[model samples]
Target: RKGGAEMTQREFKDMPSRIARLPRDKRGFPIPKFVGAVDKKGEPDFRLVSHDHMAACVRRNLCWICGDVMGTRKAFALGPMCCINRVSSEPPSHYECAVFAAKACPFLSNPNAKRRQRDLPEAGEVAGIMIERNPGVTAIWVTRFYSLMQVSNGVLFFVGEPEGLEFYARGRAATRAEIKASIASGIPHLEEVAKRDGRGAMSELKRMRKRFDALLADRVPA
Candidate 1:
């Protein structure tokens, strides 16, 4: 009986790791680290989701942005993208955070920065950054799981699937409209940053405004 129990324990321990290896929807990108909870010291760790945390977040239905427990299973999966490539690998944030991030994130707001190629010295445009959602993604996946171990330094180490195996889809058109409105409302904040950071920030905002205007122009019935 003891041997059987030990075998069961081993299987249980291995179950999540096994499930973590399963394939996920590649169309949905991983959650970005910036969307995670800050540490006790108020610093963002920028760590990817472990299988354990993924399971915890799903089981608890926590909001990635506010670290608050959510009341419902339905949540928004926000993908921070530079053109087709995903830039973040965290988890599902609150609907509000998704809208705020889409509008306020510097990478998303600034067309040049979104498309800038870090690999090249000249910093040329490579892609446009945006928050994208596929109309097809309708649910979150939580079949996979992970385990956690706390080390001596008080840091928790995620042992499996830190890149995340679960996914969420972007919100609806109303949500997109809210994001655009938030961006428009944030213009003052951009100007404040320019005031504090000087020419660099000013130039960046100018470029973003130009890009935003161009985007608006493209949407017109021309």
Candidate 2:
């Protein structure tokens, strides 16, 4: 609609609708393939349309999982399910240094949690229980950028291609050391809200971390 913009009204409206509903990058309508990913002076790769076409089309946010910043043009169809599982956990979240509280504490019952028992015998169950209670958790798609492992301290962490992270908050996955570096790097400032303690932060933190470690099938590397 705007000048210099190439997206027609039909194309513009379709982008948001796709992003809001789709979660995986491999599935979606108007199914966009690698028409040819362009690495322009300032744009990310994976271009679907001409620059003018994209400029005209409003850009959509990326799925929390894949880190794919492109709009719905490359969105997947599963809606959070596929994307989250692709990484070490299901449901996306970014926080380290918080509390965790959840229902059932699956860490106490699951067998898959055994491998992670060195630090948490019930990690798997904890993740399952959390997923059971909070079905709307946001899982990250970081398997592409990090190495998941457990530590001798029994603490789980992820070593990303660029940074390691520790999930001091909720959700599942090996808390990567790179994530901790990111947090220390003022990531919290970029966050919309300041970290605060509430009725459930601790349990949720514990459960989510365990869930994350269980999903990775490895403990945070020491």
Candidate 3:
């Protein structure tokens, strides 16, 4: 955020309400509360998440995007892989904030968008298995039950069963065809994991497939 300009109220009016509440970074992008560290030159890196900030969100029921108090139902704007596993590396946020992020973030909104490969130790160490690739499809997974589960050196949020589910691709509601395409594109990674983890993992994959199909069956729900 070193060179970032202060966002004006006028600019806020041009953006979504929840998004306008966020402070902008040097790149003119709204800085999410979940962002934790900066690059070597002290520029904030959107890719990194701060564990302290994450914990605070869970402890206070604060929205990760806007850093505001949240309602009882917390929403997670997650990638397709996270949807299947019900694991989020970040905390929950207000529905509007999460949806705005799901649509506005280049990495989440664009299937063709690629994550930059970088090593920023200042961002701190992360726990659990990381999926370096973007999930392509974003799911607004909503629930009232979620808990922080500490991993070896970091933490993760284990989302309870979704009370509401919706899918987005390229910023708008995703069609069943699009969801299926996303699943097809992403399932290979799961298959590879199952191949390495063996029969038990394979069984889980079968169940995951069922879940995936069930979501597709609804196709964003009327």
Off by over 4 Å in 2: 1-180, 183-197, 213-221
Please report the candidate that would top TM-score against the real structure.
3
- Can you rank all candidates by TM-score, best first? 3, 1, 2
Model 2, 150-184: lDDT tens digits are 44322212323212222322234324553334333
Off by over 4 Å in 1: 1-52, 77-90, 114-222
TM-score of each: 0.28, 0.20, 0.85
* Weakest 10 consecutive residues of candidate 2 by summed lDDT: 95-104
lDDT of 2 at 1: 47
On the 0 to 100 scale, the lDDT of residue 204 in model 1 is 71
**Local accuracy by lDDT, each model:** 0.36, 0.28, 0.78
RMSD each, Å = 18.0, 19.4, 3.8
Overall local distance difference test of candidate 1: 0.36
Worst 10 residues of 1 by lDDT: 79-88
- Best-to-worst ranking by lDDT: 3, 1, 2
Report the lDDT of model 2 for residue 89: 24
